[model samples]
Target: MKLYKEKLLSELQLKRLGEHQYSCSSCSYLDKFLQPYWNWLVSKVPLWLAPNLITIVGLILNIVTALILVWYSPNAKDGAPRWACALCGIGLFAYQSLDAIDGKQARRTGTANPLGELFDHGCDSISTVFVALSACIAVQLGNHPGWMFFQCFCAITLFYCAHWQTYVSGTLRFGRVDVTEAQVTIMLILAISAIFGPDIWSTKIPGTVMEMKTFLMITACGIAAFVAQANISVIFTGGIGKNGSSVAGTSVLSPIIPFSMILVPAFIIYQKSTEHVYENHPALYILAFGLVAAKVTNRLVVAHMTKSEMDYTDLSLIGPTMLFLNQYFSTFITEYYVLWLCLVWVTLDLLRYCYQICTEICDYLHVELFRIPHTGNTNTKRISSTSTSGNTEKNGTNIRNNKPPRSKKK
Candidate 1:
């Protein structure tokens, strides 16, 4: 009996080795000046206000900003009025302020927890799309479908890569020039757009015929390539982890497969929708962007909370690239046919992915994934620090005690 208990305890310890504690390293030049403003703003907020509520408010502002852009720019080609850029700029600025303040509120209220981090990140992921699409509209990039697709793809992929780097390296890195810096640049561009009318800004570059929007797109692509390359190098070379080891196996591409596959249906649906109902409807494009943003955000929440590695895979890029290429070539294939096929593929894969993550988290916590407590609320309670540690120890004890005894007969 003594030997059995010892062996059981060992197994329990291994099973209860919970996720790595979160860590981050940031070098923000703007924060040096912005910190004082942020501190003052956070001080005015009541302590009773929850941090997640702040995140939700930020998200709503993002949606509203996108809506404003769509409403004013009914024809995607003619572009939104110059003043609309000012509204989007205001909305995005508010979003950034709210997003930054939430962490401070969490610290002030003594409610900082992993769930809060997850919630904040989830909001940021979705907000990325809204902000990107809004900026695209403000600059009139949406007038060119190719550039529009490229811009959105780069923005979304940039976000995914950042999280992917964090998940694998066990460190969230904010380089000297990061998303915050890029955002400031974008805001400046929007301000310029508002100050100088779109027609004037759309004029050819000083020395070149390329428009400012195209130049901005090119610059963005270059920056994205650099950032993606750095993260990909760290993934393949095993440079960032403790003791310099890779988090994923030799096949670094497999994990990205699921995320990429999920977008297949979205691409097809987007194409058909654009062809039929959204060709002239700019608002639908914003709505489409929001749907994708929501889906990707949900996926990231599951990935981060579960501490899963998101692989660096090219397969995920192939579908979107191919679809875009087909559009560029004006393919004869009917989009509806492809859309139906992609619908089936995406549904099956999404269900499987959700079920797998749900089962893993539930089993890890030793609790029902969707269980409603006697409290009669379905909303998920934040995983407090005490409960997290307690659950680990409790799960370990239950597993150890549940082991069957060896047969008496020998």
Candidate 2:
């Protein structure tokens, strides 16, 4: 009888062990791939001097580079003091490295935060503006036409808008692993070519085919515009019909909106791509025309909303109305810097609100907003083991030792 009881208990324990083994394997797959690298880095570096410090270092380097570019602008006219340019290049390279290192360090230390993400993106935006401005200054000193300043300004503005659209839509992505590295290589080639003149490369390759820098810039702009528009469309569509009203009408308008957003930028890209010739592509022209019409319609809707009275208690309604009014006033009357600063503050506040909403949703669903390591599996195992032990004790006590011995009568 004791032998049978022991065999039964052993079987139950084996089954429980098997279940746990399966659960642990399934739960740890993702962590398994990353854990080795993470552990190695954590062992090497103190937590206090990890990712955040890298970000700060990157920010300082970028700021110094911007300042140097501004200071060296006058001397850039005699073809930018080679040493200053070299320093700027070195700073840019360092900035990129630190940018990459911060994320790596964060992953290694398992210390990523929402605030870190926000700060990283915000700093990147600021860095882009500084870098573009510096480049504009250098170009101006290089005897380029004053109009090139406007071109650079427009290019930078479009790039920022595209980046923001993707970020807000939750498709914010980086191409540093491939495209950015390739771009750096291309820039190196361009710097070398610039020193020797475009004529040197033009001789080896046909002049028409070898518009290297122009082609590269235009291609980059085109790709960025395309991706931005695609992601924006996805976001707009997803948000549609979520509020009280059906977004059917809005949905109908969505396909045309992105085209309008990219129209001017697309035209600029095409013109640059084709070397400033006005080659009429009917489809592109229609796309440009459609964008203008959409913009006009959007403005009309805004004007209508602003002119109407809205109940203050309806915060959702009032908020949008206030935003429209602010936008209108800022565009027509307010100092540009003041308007921009206000807008930035508002954007940040809105992001904070959205994050709170997401947190609430995750809580309601009983799921994590971001991955939490091992907690779920650990809890499940603890519960299972406790329950199994309780069942075994209950069954063991219920068994009558004298009754069990009666089986030996056969």
Number of the predicted model whose TM-score against the real structure is largest: 1
Q: Give me the runs in candidate 1 sitting further than 4 Å from their true place.
A: 1-20, 239-251, 262-290, 308-410
lDDT of 1 by residue, 1-410 (tens): 33112121122322332342445555556655576787799899877677668767877887787778767764456657777888788877887787777766655554444444555666676677777777777777656766776677677776776666555665555655667677777788778878886565578988889988778888888888877887776556543434554342223443465556545544564565546423454435434443443455445444444444433332223333443555556644554444333334433443344455434444443434322233333333533342333112121121011110100000
List the RMSD of every prediction in angstroms. Answer: 12.1, 20.9
Clashing pairs in 2: 260-291
| Whole-model lDDT, model 2 | 0.36
TM agreement with the true structure for every prediction: 0.68, 0.43
Model 1, residue 125: displacement in angstroms? 1.3
Q: How far is 273's C-alpha from truth in model 1 (Å)? A: 9.2
Best lDDT goes to which candidate? 1
